[model samples]
Target: MSRLTITLDDQLHRALKETAARQRRSIGSIIEESLRLRGIRTYDSAMEIVSKARAAAGLEPDEALELAVREVRQLRREKKT
Candidate 1:
């Protein structure tokens, strides 16, 4: 487990608390969810890079998309067990 202490302006703090109340969760949980939402940007960037790299490395768009989808589906199947 880890501890984090952060400072926020009055409005932002109020907003976070309100969101937590609406969701029936803690303020800490709201902050955690915010982080998770931001982390999705990393995945989006990585996929963009992969597509660009594939093109520069001579893989076609359709080929790259197909490979990405296939790998993702294969991973999901493997994780089921």
Candidate 2:
């Protein structure tokens, strides 16, 4: 496994610690789960779903990312209507 070093602000750090204590889990596990569910898919495992879609649509990764951004903007506009 790989280790990541991130700098969290004091309040966020404290919150993570508290969550870990409450759930009886390591801080790393909590962070991992949060990253997985946060909807902003930057991690490889998260991106794989988009990657598969791009392949099915015959799009390159960069093209897929741009298209995804446009779709999100369109959705936001529709929501505001």
Q: Estimate, for each residue in 1-81, the C-alpha lDDT of model 2 and write its tens digit.
A: 899999999999999999899999999998887654444455675477667769888998988877766765676566556
Give the Å error, residue 53, model 2: 5.7
TM-score on alpha carbons, each prediction? 0.47, 0.51
- The top-ranked prediction according to lDDT is 2
lDDT of 1 by residue, 1-81 (tens): 589988899999998888888989998877777665544346777598568767766878777777766765676566555
Model 1 clashing residue pairs (backbone): none
Off by over 4 Å in 2: 40-81
TM-score of 1: 0.47
Candidate topping TM-score: 2
- Candidates in order have lDDT scores of 0.73, 0.77
What lDDT score goes with residue 15 in model 1?
88
